[model samples]
Target: MKRIHGYVLLRESNQGIPNLLVCAFDAEGAVQDLLGARRGAERPTLTFGKLGKRIGSVLTGTDGAFELTRDDLHFEGVESRPDLVLAVLAPEDVVDPRRPVALPPEQRILYISAVPRSEAGAEEAYVIRLQQAQLDAFGIALDTSADNAHKRIAATQALLGDVEAGTQIRAQVAGRLHGRLKTQHRREVEFRDQAKKAVQLVALPHGLRAHPLLLSEASKLPDLQKKALTEGIRHLKDAHRPQLRISLRAAELRTAGMKLDRRGKPIGKINTLKLADVLRNMLGGVSLVRKDEVEPSALSDIALRARSATRTRARGAVDRAGEEGQGKALAREPGRTTAKAVKSATPRRDRRK
Candidate 1:
């Protein structure tokens, strides 16, 4: 039944080293809701979210001051705000020093630590730790063969076994890893396909069907059309691996069609025209640009259309004005008097004769 909550504070260092800090509040303490738009104050019983368990957790002291060391530090990627979660740990969940059952969550502790552990392989341990934490916190179970097995395999699969057991265990672990990979791959493909169909495409290239428009990246593209092209390519390519052929950048972004008048004023709107959608365009074929290339300003599809329309209107006006001038000159020619005036002049001349 014990619980705690807190806000994460961002501490920046000039040297670019990763350090983490969490300002945990009492179980019923008052704090602003960082996750909300209104950010109203709430006193939730469990604020330290589930991920709090894996992150830097420091024990509280008698003086109400929780000290943290470099060992308790690790950086998580960007968060809307620093927030903690609640842990309803049973008394038996006492193995972790961070969650000592003897001390309640009211101490309002801060967690920090130094990560001296080096990465074992290609991926950094910290990144994996963060991803694992996320998966553990909000993971769903699958009723696959792995769960149906009656074998009570624990410790990430057979840790202690006979002399020949090492090879067998390694093979078992490899099989499990392969199974996990296949499941992940299947889910990723399904999700990507769904995303592609859901979004109204503003621009799509032929070759790179796997990659879709990244709205987060596109919104940052420059506003001018000339610049939107060059800069959009640079930003898009930078987001992925150097070798990844991002055939289209802003071009793939979804845009809202802004219906505009001849004066460049918005006469109507297309709902999808977000900032990023306008900076890119889709052509008959995909545009290719390397990460080392140029940058451009942002412009919307509506704006481009409006600009074109305005130019067309101006040209038509000039043509109409010339036709009207010629018509006026013909009406003002010398023998062009009205019928009544001509009759009056002839009658006076006939009477005198």
Candidate 2:
């Protein structure tokens, strides 16, 4: 009866429809194999531990919402096995749902455990937001078709076998992908430099994931080259163990709400004002006081300043004008004066008298 319950909140903007698999695997020596499972000749299989098992699966809602409950999970022995770890399938490894996904012969049957650190409990609430940029890196397109649902389901079943293999595969893909993407960027130094700066900014607790300088500069790149660099940065982030390995329950707090205003209240529709702000908060660290704000800079400042200085200046001018008006009014009507002004005036009046 004891198990974890949660929701996977995909960003409303992501094009891909991610199918989540609740998989269980042994947390022992099998980690190595699991990390490289996506590249392995055979499906990811656990060694020296229980074979990976798919407890449950669900396709995300149109709004990118999917729920996971005890009913979704098949294994009841999760609590008894401390070594048993559950993972939500990573987007990269997901078969593209838009078309009849024909993964490369070698890449097919590979599993990527994007988030694999959930524990079994009576009831736990988790909300994970999958970014559009990251999905693009994985080549997962948005699901626009209603007929392709079964294709994805079939794809999911094709890969299910052992959990440990999926777990280990992500680690290797991260390393290999980093080298591959960097090599690709080497031909274009500009792309590499921008990507490097992005990496540094994104790693900070208060980093802006989408700074204007990067965006503007990237916008100028050839479409293919720009996409390559963007995906490169995403791969690096997807590989980061701290962000990747952070407990799912904690991730929920980090990536909450569909769309929020400056005050962090949910709005009726998508708010572009808070889009980058929300993304910045989700990547590096969660800030309760304020989201990461990008400063005016050349390369990276994260999100642009949310409040405008022009507005602030306007308010200051209004206050100064009010003070000047008060002084002019006193001069226009000398009888209407403060006690201190009248007190000083009395001495002058007596001398005049």
Candidate 3:
């Protein structure tokens, strides 16, 4: 069995903390927790109370170097191969406060994977490197389809064959594309619904139902409320796209200084960002541009309408105040019908008779 080594370095000058958690999914798809907390530094192995299982300790150095020194956690072994490897870096563990968004422990996990050739629509395999900044700025998620490329090609080829048999290719392509977009849109709506459920909503005294709140506004809440939002986003991501198997930019993956495998596919080390990160940034006020305009327009319009309504109410209050003040001044003027004068001038003959 080949021994595998993993290294985690803090390259930024004043960015992240040394504390981290490295987790993996075994061949059987069970999540195996690899401990990296400071409490278990001296101990050779730490035991989990719930699982009753012991695993090797992952240690960190004083200079912000985190390494899995033991070869016991090999990725090449028959039974030890991992389907995915992820690193969890919590908000507290991150030293930089300059970032626009901060994610909770569960949502902060960065997926590290080598995208296969078939998935990339290429003859050779490549690794994609994603960072926190890219995810924060663009709000783009990693495509996590296993064989989406092949499926698309097969569909297109069948359409071409139909064209040769006298069918209109352009119309067929348009129909297929429209169907795919509708499915994608539906999934996006479902994901947002799940995310909103994670937020804590407060009930209003004036109404029977809870107060209406946007996910972006609810995400600004403190403590447990914020945690719930992040967890909800992660759950949605896990269900929709579990693996980061999307095609990436070729310019980002360099050919030079890369080690090739027996089949000539480049196997290189790359950093990663997650789709969950995109959600975090979006809720944190980062503007996201998507291929479909309706999706982003729906969210931005909600916030816009809320702000507009607030301004309208403020203007109405000011106008009412001014009108009341003018009316009181007019009543105080000479010859005006004051409350006492009006009552005194009223007919008293009926009462006297």
Candidate 4:
């Protein structure tokens, strides 16, 4: 009785028969003859109203079989393209053939693309568009497979747990050294430096858990080296907590992989950071916190010395100012100025000529 528009979702429901539905129109307007239509069979250009929203071609069995289905059309709401739809899959809605989908406010139809595609050039473009929409809006592009959502979530939770565990271990190790810093601070300079390198070895958050080589490297860290690193961290932390954080970050950079763009890097590739490479990079970064960290007492001494120097300079400046003022006053008085001028002007009898 009425003409409306929607996208055609052609999917195999049973027995290799692709059930076709125009999402804009209800089941009454659905094209069910797709089962009889060949894969490349000629389908009509279906449109509705004056807007001419492309509902895609209908692959009907007979030349005019589509007309009989179109005649079954009734008053149902229509939309152009993949307009978000309300999906109601409750038990009541499942049992009832006439139940309208209930869309709670602000809820969206999930990733299932209700947009119909022609059998030709539409797939790749639609895929790219969907990927872009997900990435741009949500800060992540999820795998398009409908069945992989739970697996993806599980993998994410596992990764987060690993990161947290790595952080806890790193903290525990650092704490053990910090508690005994007073006793261990006098370790040999070479030993301390080696310990710093050792800390860098274990700083790789992801690699530590993911890479077998890294675990071996961690297990091989000598006790002296470990102690040295703990002492270094404690000293740096005492010197400046921020410096310690920076050192840890620098070490992290050497040992960890950066967030890679999806376009370039393959997913699930574990980055192999070598112990030698980590040691080399650690020489620069791990020592920085130790070097930059100034003791609180040393800082206080510097302040005190600076203040004393400043006071001395101020006193000298005051003396100079006083002399300048006296000279200016004498110059302002005409008689005093003349007397001084005459005294200087009088050719000193050149006894030492």
On lDDT, the candidate that comes out on top is: 2
User: How many clashing pairs per prediction, in order?
Assistant: 32, 14, 0, 0
RMSD of each: 39.3, 45.6, 49.5, 34.8
Summarize candidate 4's per-residue lDDT along 1-353 as a digit string, tens digits.
Answer: 22222221212211111122212222212232322344363332222321122332232121111221233332235432232211111111222358666433112212222333322221122110122342233232223342245446768999999999999999998888886775667566668789877874455576456753333445666764777778788887784534322233433443554333457442333245543355557676442334565567766877879979999999999999999999988767455556677777777685345
Give per-residue CA lDDT, model 1, range 1-353, as digits (tens).
12222222112211111122233221222232332344353322333442242434443222112433334434357321223332222112244587665433422222222221222121221110122232233231222343324234543355555535978888889888998989999999999879978984656455554543333345545444556577788988785754533232222322344444568455444354453343344434444557653334326677669879999999999999999999987887686887786778786768688
Question: Whole-model lDDT, candidate 1?
Answer: 0.41
Q: Which ten residues in a row have the lowest lDDT in candidate 2?
A: 105-114
lDDT of 4: 0.40
TM-scores for the candidates: 0.14, 0.26, 0.19, 0.15
Pairs in clash, predicted candidate 4: none
**Predicted model with the maximum TM-score:** 2
The candidates, ranked best first by TM-score, are 2, 3, 4, 1
Where's the lowest-lDDT run of ten residues in candidate 3? 116-125
Give the runs in model 3 whose Cα sits over 4 Å from its true position: 1-4, 10-17, 27-59, 69-84, 91-105, 114-353
Candidate 2 lDDT, 114-209, residue by residue in tens: 344444345444455566654555565665574256556656776763455786797788877998888777868987788888865445334555
Preferred candidate (TM-score higher): 2 or 4: 2
- Give the worst 10-residue stretch by lDDT in candidate 4: 84-93
